[model samples]
Target: MSGPVDPARIRDAIAQFGRTLGPDVLASCRALFGAQQEALSCAVPAAARDLAYGPHERHRLDLYGAAGEAPKPVLLFVHGGAFVGGDKGDPSDPARWHNGAVGRMAARRGWIGAVMNYRLAPDHPWPAGAQDVGAAVDFLRAHAADHGGDPDRIVIMGTSAGAAHVGGFLRLRPDHADLVRGAILLSGLYGITPLEPKDEEYYGAADSACDKSPLEALASTPLPMMMACAQYDPARFQAEYLGLLQKRLTRHGALPCSMSLPGHNHYTIAMHLGTSDRRLEDSIAEFCDRLFA
Candidate 1:
């Protein structure tokens, strides 16, 4: 039998296909990505909790934890679905990578893991989605005591589109600053610039949407942050955007810890957090520990 699979080669293959494939075919590609995640060997336990924030439909928060009485730190996760598709419940499904791996891993680590669903795109749009996330945070804070969580020690984590929502939350509602002690943003999109020529309908014009960019929203507030991405991500501009945001943060005297997953692709890097990979998940846990320490 051959040696273990090479993550670099896997990333390169995905990036190549992303460049060659049309936008409509991306969903199928994403499904393939999910399939890859499900094949990994890891076990974590998760539970479902449903609650209503306001007039919106009852949202679900997936909780993960080891069976113990320890009052662990809370990690609130928001999944990326391009502001169009994706459910917190979907990630928790056994068929998917994100819900199965990451959510379970967080719980196994003695954290009160919470993955929540927010309103999607077109039907919801920018701030609406961010507001939904904010409400989830509020709900968690209000009920953390009941869930055996320390409301003062909460970390907001997100990937891709979900990361954008976290960024928006930080920018739009500074009052909620106390609600989150730190953030973990993975392969996230921060700039409001369109990813494609026809993406203007969803992302809006770049010039006028500058305020919507996380980089811009971060100009005044200096929250501790950790930004990460994969080297072989087809979305190369995401790295560039992170760099720009880093530079801005530096100029504003706010330096964020950052990392580039050496051999992983965008999908793999994001999903790896769900695995027992000490290299990634441990680092994230360490970061949060220090932030709340």
Candidate 2:
């Protein structure tokens, strides 16, 4: 087992960046977390890669510990790239020990862990990601037993743009409620506010974006959920997180499980999974256990 992550060390490494979200900060944190994941390279089970969930080239998913026992709860993860770009694995590294580390962590905890890629924006546009998510869910549900997963106990987790897609699925495909047991959203654009520029590339102009926003729908949905934002995330994501909390509270009279991850930022928040940092991972496992129970 890996040792616990040193929050102090992570804080010092990014102190100079100071809450900025950009290539420099993202690169720095990627390298740091990549190294942490690399150290556990020998521990994670090999993943079954590039399984097609749809006809599109990007409709692919990788599953870890998939050939194991029967009826394990499913944990599907969606990676974020602001809707313009992102992948389930680090493109440059074939070993893929970094970006998809969360899936490996889920496998370690005895769940069928999945990481997937979806169609990008400017070409696919609004609802495409959600459509891909729906396809993935369908594929997983159909083959869950073959892959040692429980089709009915699936939980989808997403970060940033990925979270938007999950929220979109919830809003647009509420009929799938019986298939998905819960959700975890990290720093996603929930449509509580206007779309950012990069997001507009996916959601389109103001009117279209508003029409496609999932905030109102997600607020009223009764799905079990857990949400959080990084302590050092930019203001927009912070606002989105707060917006969802307030909306859910006002609409449902209660808040979903949530947290402000300390000593981390947007990138490191997800990157640190499987790296001895049990804070977020532990919470996710607890949430899953509660739902799967």
Candidate 3:
């Protein structure tokens, strides 16, 4: 196996990607974590933009597709922002992660990649994100063919809070089970206890939290999963990943293929997705590709 990336160089690269030469929003990720370098997700152009999956202001997604390709597998990415704030696209900068970066990577890999935005918390509360995910799936399942995506082959990839929403949808009685072929959960909360006040607010009541915990709910007839965390992630998230891995192993007798993104922390891992760092990307692709095959 290759060694961890040089944190110093990774830090410099992150500043470059954000088009901010000095420390700020993206650069602060490392400083806040006491880690050398955090992840920086870069972006690219979309074949289409601001496509509405639902009527809500936030229920929109961006599509990255190969022109004239009518039938390609789809990778719909759900972003994370603690369930309070996050968007699918960053119209202000190409250096930011969101629709462009991830979608570009998926399109490059010969799949129809997409990034979506959904209602956030405080106002929306628990299950709102999951509901939005369901709507996005429904939209894709019905119309992916019109935009060169094969509705039958769709994978949902979520990070952090987004993973919680994906988890909820996965256990939503498998109604759209056939449409969503696989899932990739990165540094997810998994409904574990001791949530911060902000998380508690967004997730709602304690009883509601129990109902929403992905780790507990995923035991029976869980779909194929890829559970991952970063080397420098917050200790809590690392624990969450390990717990999920153990759950999968004990229940299924085999661990789902997962990884620790070396030289990466929670925020930095997703940024590496569109870059040359293929360790995490390759593992995710392999997992999804096998499902498609």
Best by TM-score: 2
RMSD of 3: 5.8
Candidate 2 has a TM-score of 0.94
- Give lDDT tens digits, candidate 2, residues 146-244: 878889989999999999999999888868678799889998999877766777889998766788988877898888899989888888899999999
- Across 1-293, the per-residue lDDT of candidate 1 in tens digits comes to 02454556545556665433244444444454454345442344455555565566635676766435756788888887666766664444644445445566667667788887787766666677677778889887887767677778889988777888888888778785678888888877776344553333345665555556766654455667787776666555455456646665667665677777665555556555553345778778788889767
Please, what are the lDDT tens digits per residue for candidate 3 over residues 51-108? Answer: 8999888988988866453589999898888788767756455334433556777887
Q: List per-candidate RMSD values in Å.
A: 3.8, 2.4, 5.8
**Candidate 2 Cα misplacement greater than 4 A, ranges:** 1-6, 90-96
Which ranking of candidates, highest lDDT first? Answer: 2, 3, 1
Candidate models: Cα lDDT each:
0.66, 0.84, 0.73
TM-scores for every predicted model: 0.81, 0.94, 0.85
TM-score of 3: 0.85
* Residue 36 CA displacement from its true place in model 3, Å: 19
Better of 2 and 3 by TM-score: 2
Candidate 2 clash pair list? none
Worst 10 residues of 2 by lDDT: 90-99
**Which of the numbered candidates is closest to the native, going by highest lDDT?**
2
Error of 3 at 64 (Å): 0.4
